[model samples]
Target: MIGRIMKIVSRQYTLLGENGEKHDAILMGKVRRQDVPAAGDLAEAEYVNGRWVIQKILPRRNRLIRPSCANIDQALIVMSVKDPDFSPALVDRISMLIMKADITPVLIITKCDLGIPDETEEMIREYENGPMKVIRTAKDEASDEVAAILEGKISVLTGQSGAGKSTLLNTLEPSFHLATQEISKALGRGKHTTRHNELHSVAGGLVADTPGFSSLDFSHVSASELGSCVPDFIPYLGKCRFNDCIHQNEPGCAVKEAVESGSVPQRRYRNYLGVLEIIQNRKEKYL
Candidate 1:
C-alpha cells in the first residue's frame, strides 16, 4: 500500500493512509540503507505482524533544502515591513531558489499595520508586476486573499526569523496554536520557535512551517545559470547583444537597458548583480 508521510520523528514515521487511517510506520532495512523519506514523501508501505513498514520512497516533484520538505507546489516567502526591516535581496534569493526547484513563489508581506516604508512599498509594487503573486497582511486584520491563495496548493512557509511566519500561520488557522515568540528588541529578531519542518492541513491544502533564517547562500547555483533564476529578466534575456551575456557590464544588454529605462526595478537589478557576484565567486573558488 502507498501512503503519504505526515510526520517523521526519529525512526518513526506517521503516514496518512489512503483509507483515511493514520499509521505509525518504520523504515525497512533496505529503505533505511538508502535515502530517508522526508515528511511530505509518498512511500510504499506494508502492514505485517501488526507493524507498518515503509519499503520505498516514491519520486518527488520538488524539494527544499533549507526546510527539508519535498513535493512542494509553492513557496510563501514571508517578509516583514518594519521589525527586522524588509530585505528585497533576501526575497530575490529565496524566490530564485524556489524557481530553481520548479515551485511557484508567492511573496507575503507582513506587518502592514506598522506602516511600510515608501521604498519598500514601491518594491512590493514592482514584485507584483513581476512573475510571482504578492500578498500583504497585517496582525490586526485577517487576509481573505491570502487564505484563498493557499487553498488547494501545497505550500512551504519560510522567511527571516523575525518576519512573523508562524504568526501569519496562526492567523490563517486560529486553532493551529503554533508557538510564537516575541522579537528580541536588542537583537532585532525573534526567537526560533519552529525547530523542524512539519506539514499541517490548512486552507484546503497542506502547509509546511519551516525554520527561519536571516540569510541564504547559493553555493549550489552556478554563475552561468543564475540569470534564468530571476523571473523578471526572462523577457530581455535573448535580446541582449551577446548570445552568452551574463548581463553584467555587457554592451547592449537588454536587462541593463530595462533597468536604465525604469522598466525593471533598480533594487531588484542591484540585488541580482549582488547574487551573481556571489555565485561567480563561489565558482572561482572551486576552480
Candidate 2:
C-alpha cells in the first residue's frame, strides 16, 4: 500500500493511507539504512505480521532542509512589518532558497494593523512586480485571499521567530492550536515555540508549520550558484558582459545596471551581494 506521511514524531511515522485510513508505521530495515521518510513523503508501506512498515520512500519533487519536509509546492514566508520589524534581506534569502529548490515563494506581510513603514511598503510593491506573489494581513483578521493561495498546494510556512507565523496560522485555522510565544521586549525576539514540522490539512491543501529561525545560513549554496537563486537577476542572467559574471564589481553587468537604473530593487541587490559574500567566504574557508 502507498501512503503519505502526515507527521513524524521520533522514530514513528503517522501515514495517511490512500483509503483514508491512518497507519502507525515503522521504517523497515532497508529504508532505515537508506533514506528516512519525512512529513509529506509518499512511501510504500506493507503490513508485516500485525504491524505496518514503510518499505520505500518515493522520489520527492522538492525538499526543505530547515523544515525537513518533502514535496512542497510553495512557501508562505510570514514577515512582520513592526514588532520584530521587517527584514527584507531575510525574506530574499528564504525566497532564494525556495526557488533554488524549485518551489514557488509567496510573501505574507503580517501586522499591517500596526502600520507599515513607508520604505517597507515600497519594498513590498517592488516584490509584487517581481516573481513572487505578495499578500498583506493583520492580527485577528481572517483573509480569504490567503486561503486561496494555500488551496490545493503543499506549503511550508516559515519566518523569523517573532514574525507572528504561529499567530497567523491560528488566525487562518483556529483548530491548529499551534503554540506561540511573546516577543521578549528586552531581546526583541520571540522564543522558539515550534520545535518540529507537522503537515496539517488546511484550505484544501497540506501546510507544514515549521520551526522559526532568527537567522539563515546559506552554507549549502556555492558562490557560483548564488546568482541563479535570486529571481530578480533571472532576466539578465547570460546578458552580462562576462558569461560568468557574479553581478558584483563586474563591468557591463546587466544586473548591476538594472539596480542602477532603478529596475531591480537596490535593497534586493544589496542583500544578494551580502549573501554572495557569505557564500564566497565559506568557499574560501573550505578551500
Candidate 3:
C-alpha cells in the first residue's frame, strides 16, 4: 500500500512497496498536484485495478535546485583538471549553496592521474585548508576516496559534464554502470549522458548523477545573506566595525582584513565579491 518511489520514468514510477514488490506506478491526481515525487520519496501508493498509482508524497528534509532531488544528506562536487577542465568560481558557488541549505559539501577533484592544473590545485588546497573537506580521485585507481566521503550519506554528484561524476560513482560501486560520456571535440565540452535525476545505490549510500552545466545561476541567494554562506566568514561576522558590513571595502571590516592576512582564501573572497555584485544587481530575483 505504501512505498518509496525509487525512480520515475515516462510518467511511471518504480515503487518499492512495504511488501517488497517493486511495481510500476502511475501518479494519481492529488499526488501529482502536491509536488514532484523525486527518488527516495516515501510515498503512499496502491495496486488498484491491477495498476499501481502513487497517492501521496511525504515531506522532504532538503531539495537541490538544478538536479531537483530531495532529502539530501550532503553533496559531492566533482571537477576535472583536464579534458573539460575545472572552474573554481563554479565550485565555490555550489559549495556556498550547499552550506546555505545546511547540507555538507565535499569537494572531489578528478583526473589526478593526468595531474592537476595550477589553479585547480590551488582550489583544492583552499577547500581542504578551510572549513570544507576535499578529496582527490583518479581514474583506473583503487582509491575509495569518494566512497569514504559518502559513507552512510545520501550524497548528490554535481559538476560540469565530463568532470567524472559518473566515473567516480562507477568506481564506488562497479555494479551501478551509469552511462558516461566523452568530452566533445568540436565544442570542447562534455556531451550530456545523465538525462534525469535518479538515485543509485552506492557503497552504504545513495548518489544522484545529474546533468552538468557550464555554470549555475546564484540568483536565488541575496548579497547580504551571501557572506553567511561562506562558512569561514562566520567567525568574523559580528566583529566588524559596522553591524551592516557587507565585507567589501567597508571601514574596519574584519572579513576584508582576513582576506588580506591570508586567513581566508583570496580567491574565495574574490568569488564572494563577484557573487555579491551579481546578487546586488538582481536583489529582487533572490528575495
Question: If candidate 1 were superposed on the true structure by all CA atoms, what would the RMSD be?
Answer: 2.7
What's the lDDT for candidate 3?
Answer: 0.77
lDDT of 1 by residue, 200-283 (tens): 878777788885323476777776677878888888888999988998988999999999998888988989899899888877
lDDT of 2: 0.83
Models 1 onward score TM values of: 0.91, 0.91, 0.87
For model 1 the TM-score comes to 0.91
Q: Which residue ranges in model 1 land beyond 4 Å of their true spot? A: 183-191, 212-215
Candidate order (lDDT): 2, 1, 3
Q: Please report the TM-score between candidate 3 and the true structure.
A: 0.87
Where does the lowest 10-residue lDDT sum fall in candidate 2? 182-191
lDDT of 1 at 214: 32
Candidate 2 TM-score, true structure as reference: 0.91
- RMSD to native for every prediction? 2.7, 2.7, 3.2
**Candidate 2 residues 1-287, lDDT tens each?**
99999999888999988676898999988887898678989999999999998989999987766788899898888989888888888898988887777888899999999997898888788888887788999989978999998887788887877688778778889787777774344445445667677888787778888753234767677777788888888888999999988998989999999999988889999999999988888888878
Q: Which stretches of candidate 2 lie over 4 Å from their true place?
A: 182-190, 212-215
lDDT of 3 by residue, 1-287 (tens): 77766678879888766665688889998778868778877778777899987888888888666676777888787888778777788888887888777788877888989987677677678878888777887887646766676676677777877788888878777776776774234445446667676777677666778763335677677667788888778788888898888998789999999998999988889998988888787865546
For model 2, name the residue pairs that clash: none
Cα lDDT computed for each candidate against the true fold: 0.82, 0.83, 0.77
